[model samples]
Target: MRPQRLSDVVGQQHLVGPGKIIARMVAAKLLSSMILYGPPGTGKTSIASAIAGSTKYAFRKLNAATDSKKDLQIVAEEAKMSGTVILLLDEIHRLDKTKQDFLLPHLESGRIILIGATTENPYININPAIRSRTQIFEVKPLTLTDIETALERALTDPERGLGKLPIKLDDDAKRFMADATNGDLRSALNGLELAAQSTPPAEDGTIHITQAIAEECFQRKAIAGDKNGDAHYDVISAFQKSIRGSDTDAALHYLAQLVAAGDLPIICRRLMVIAYEDVGLANPPAASRTVQAVQAAQQLGLPEGRIPLANAVIELCLSPKSNSAMVAMDAALTDVNAGHNGAVPDHLKDAHYAGAKKLGHGNDYKYPHNFPNDWVKQDYLPAGLKGSEYYQPKMNGRFETQLAEQYHRLRKANQ
Candidate 1:
């Protein structure tokens, strides 16, 4: 069901409620081109419809990817006749240069108040011309209470909702519908409608919708909508944090959540980052395997991909954790960033070029491979910043333990 006024919008009170941006625009009658971005079924269209209805303007809709320029001409004609028309352009990110050029003048002259809707980051995907003309707004996912309010309204509203049907929705069933959609109001409503229509009326002439029926109508469990949306990021953050915390079970739980969402690219990317950032030098072999597992996962798509991904996740969680490499790098980077650097020692400078020996470059340099144990103690740091120590190896794993021993030994010899 679509809202006829901005006040009727179920969620996004931040934008549509009293004193909000869109509401202020409608109240002041200062309509301008705008873009609404979020996951599907979050009232982008409803908000556009409500704005048009509230302002007494004609409402039109067309998909930028599928509709032709002829379709836009029809809306422009209507806008000319009616003075103003609110056009809801779906997949506005896909609007080509041709369509954009045709609509630019109408937007400039205030003939058409374009309400562009997309699931993509409009700033990155939309052409600069379109973005310049439109004020971008993000429609957030409906909260549990917000979805419940919409559900209740849909049950009793006779004009645009399934009011005539005598249906009994259990409390648990209602919650199932809300949570299963992950803040998608449209899917929840559709699933509810499916349950009500498919189930035959009971002996008392009332159709009962239970949680089990709701699940059946959903068919698959919640596949998170909008990979860039907040909920998806929350799950991903939890996934990486669990692995870093060495909680294998919790890590797998989050992994399963992401796998169900089917964002393989993000899964592979985050896993590789965790391998080096969280489980570095302490378990180099495990980190290396993590990289290989991600490669294998990429080769084999989902279902099979999940196998290698799972192995990588388990190994990373159980491996001895160390961030010493990351810490060391950060320490060095900090010095460089803060202007704690100086000119390289002449001995360390290249002497291959002509006249380099006259500049004293490499004149005192001693090759480390020619010395005992392929090592030599020398002043590697510049004179102004002498004896700088960056690496502090952790004795968390066998490899790093041996590395720490050699590193300290070299330090002692230099001293």
Candidate 2:
């Protein structure tokens, strides 16, 4: 049967469930720009389609990976005129920066209710401006139970369903199907359909799913809808975990997998960010080194880039690890998110610009150079966070130990 309604959606109740954010938005007819993010076959496109089918608004679809900038401009023009377009941009991360910029003004003006879809992390892959304007909801893979329910529905439903299939799915067979799919619902259903069509019928007119047959079916299974699909997240997770577990070899292996599979440069850049975030100051060198490595790769291109990348990976794995910087950054972000924004202290404001000094910029600013060792204790943070420690160094290596020593000396002298 056509999966026409939310009730028909096999999984992702987390998004479509009663009183959930999307469901609430739908019920209230309060649609906003949104991005549905998840791995392939988790129904990103299907969900958009369902929303379009159910809502009163106009729906437009385009694959950013293949669509030209001109095509996108036309869609934006249409959206501007209509002002009711639910523009579903599939593979939105593939759009070049210029193509992305084309949509920014339209999004800002509320001409289109953008429903972007991506198998990649939107925060990492999407243009920051477009992403900022949209609400993101992750659609999770279907559970085995959900897959089984989908199978049953497929077998029983009339239209768009597996019709008149005389098949007996033994426990082993069903387990094989579910396990093979790795929570991909479309895969499970397609596999079931293949088994029904190919397996010969017995005297009872029912097909038996034996282990031998299952293996053969799996080997010959048609390429799933997503060729370069679910593997993206799986590989990235492996790379991050390997680095976390301090397995340089494994981390490099995953990196090679992505590079071999044609992952985007920005994806690598994001992982470098994680290198700083998860493996910061403990290995203060990691972030900077990773940044340099990415630049090298970009400049050298492919085969040659692998060398610098390998070196960077080795450095990161061996370097002492700490997440203190990440902790501090996150805490600072929390303050900003909570509207704890404080204006730059007058003394900290720039004085070189015209009329800046007239506005008291840098007025009464202490000349620390005149102090002993060109060092002096002073308030650096905003008023509310003054003297509030953010970077608490973990004493493990040269950088952190030096930082800790400085903090200790500063604290004692100030006291």
Candidate 3:
């Protein structure tokens, strides 16, 4: 019921194609435990099964969600009896500590070769101990052409497919099914089977499948994402990074993915953070615009809200990036954490009350407005930290460049 050869596996050519990592390992019979991660129905299980079949290894499939520790024991025992066992663990991201503890020894001993399959990002969900022992390959979504090919294979193949039935599917119907499934071959195949089986045969004993039947069989494919899962974080992270990296195209792509996932609040918050943290003083206006956009998104809500969010994302991505403010804050924090708590200069201390003048507060504090250019050379920092320069703005954008120039001129004049 699944692909027996790597060559027959649809999509994920990056891992299973000729001369690819999986193909090379299989060809050399040098199998290693690995994790296949991606969206649902992307051949994770099929690829694992194919590897097991090709290598002639005893294959066992277990669902991490339902399978207990005893199931792992059985697999381990079987592996001990029969050289090695290829264990395909589904929902591996949900693997508990107890199961991980039980499986680690067998994995290290080569008695169990784990093929972990997860719809979540393993790096974010799986235990590092388990992850370190296996190679991780991301299986991509199947293209429409790939889905069509698989559908065709299922339609004509006699033994495991629907070939036994005299079914006639129109070209448009095939395209509809392939496109409707949204790169999920399993959905496409299931829909095909449904249409073939449910439709009554005509006088010629041939079951006719039309686009309407295909649509009825399969609903629109839901967006391949969970708002609270690894995909959510991954997409948001990509969105922020793309904006920071100033890749408008990539930023928009990730933004769309998040919007499709319906996590508008998270996207809005992340955009605000990106504007200030990444786009900082380089374009202060961008940061203000990002705040306004987030406010607009909050007020407008979904569907319409995405408009302002998109505007903010594109504007932030195009804006000049500068991390000098972040760097400066971090540098200051580093000094503070490293026991640099020098007392504030007496003159700089608050001296609002009448008695405060007796403590030398504001005794010699020079008012900058009283001097030429509205600036004055004064030791503002505590004595020991007078010359310590935490903020060194980069000449990246017009605003930061002007600030940097003024900063240097002030430092020189003060010296």
Candidate 4:
């Protein structure tokens, strides 16, 4: 059943749980303009539906993938007169800058409670002006537990679920189905329904779905080149691993396969990531060279672009590799995610603003440029994170060699 209430909604606890911002908004009936950003089938639309269902407000839906300015204008006019209108804008990034700009006025005026959904990051896809005007909440992908619960409800709920059908799901089939769905509830349910429909009746007169039956029902292999399809991730993984494993031959093979399949840009990007992540400072040239490959591909366009791509791949395969840089960045990002954010140091605080100096913004700040050899000790990081080294450059090429000499000199001079 399409859940009619928030309690019935699966996943998305951070937004709808007790005392959450959205929950408070719903209770007070103060639903404002918001953008829900996440991957497909993460219940962005369902959240909008729940909000609309709870109120005596007008509900209008528009898919930016299909709707034009005229459609938006019609909705805007209706919203202006209505007490409250929950306008669902799906794939709003499909709208050009001009069209996105057009919605800004209505959103700011509070005429429409904008509930925009995008699979892409809105900051990258949406106009900054419009993005600033709306509250953005990211919807996380559904977990396996969430999918299992939804499937259980679907199997038993007589009114809108599969209770009417002669279907029986074994534990293995249910587990496989959940894994295959990969957090997309719509796909999971669709797969289950398809399997149930195709499954033959068992001796007990119920349609029992097995692993083989499920696979047979969904056997049309999704093309490996389709970016929005299942093959996209698999191909990219194969390509990156081949390079990382120093298999230039296999790497070239996958590269050619991607090129022949016409997904050249994706291949270029995968190489770029490998350059930075796999090769890194062990050979800084890898990243520069990977960038050049992308530029060459853009310039020569196709057949000739293959030359630079090949050269870059071979070079990266032969180069000394290190993940030190990548590891440092990832570790720092993990800390940020864990909410270990420390405050800015006083010396590092901006002193350009009026009265900033009076507030001790730059008190005791040391100018490294004025010090001997431009080397001085000062609190570069926040007080709480003092002596916390994020980037411990490995002893490798240019970065390591230079850093080693500097550290030696600094130690001797300070002593």
Per-candidate TM equals 0.64, 0.52, 0.59, 0.69
Worst 10 residues of 2 by lDDT: 220-229
Per-residue lDDT over 137-234 for candidate 1, one digit per residue giving the tens place of the 0 to 100 score = 99988887899899988899888888989988877678767766878899999998899889999999999987668767987443343222346567
- Candidate 4: where is the Cα deviation over 4 Å? 68-82, 96-109, 127-129, 220-279, 285-323, 326-345, 370-393, 396-402, 407-415
> Which is the better candidate, 2 or 4, if ranked by lDDT?
4
Off by over 4 Å in 1: 221-245, 249-305, 308-312, 319-415
lDDT string for model 3 (1-415, tens) is 5999888788888998999999999999888899999878889999998998889999999999999999999999999899999999999999999999999999999999999999998889999999999999999888878998999999899999988999899877787777666578888898999899899999999999976677678753223423222443567788888998889999989887767645675788788889889999999999999999999998998779989998998899888889899999999999999999799999899999998999889989999999898998888877878789989798779999999998999899998
User: Cα lDDT of all candidates, in order?
Assistant: 0.89, 0.74, 0.87, 0.79
Provide the clashing-pair count of each candidate structure: 0, 0, 0, 0
Best model number under TM-score = 4
Q: In model 2, which runs have C-alpha deviations exceeding 4 angstroms?
A: 56-58, 73-83, 108-111, 220-415
Which pairs of residues collide in candidate 3?
none
Better of 1 and 2 by lDDT: 1
lDDT of 4 at 253: 84
TM-score-based ranking, best first? Answer: 4, 1, 3, 2
Q: Write the per-residue lDDT of candidate 2 for residues 241-328, one digit (tens) a residue.
A: 7877789899889777756544436346656876786678776667887888888887888777888888887787777777888888
lDDT of 4 by residue, 1-415 (tens): 6667777788998998778878889899788888899978879988888888877578888988788889888988898787557899998777677668788788888888889999999989887776887899999989878988898889888898988877788765665566555578888888888887777787888998875565555552223423233454576788888888889898888787776554565667788889999888888867897898888896897777888989998998887777888888988898889888899888888898999988999887888999877878665666676656576666757775676577666555544
Show the lowest summed lDDT stretch of 10 residues, model 4: 220-229
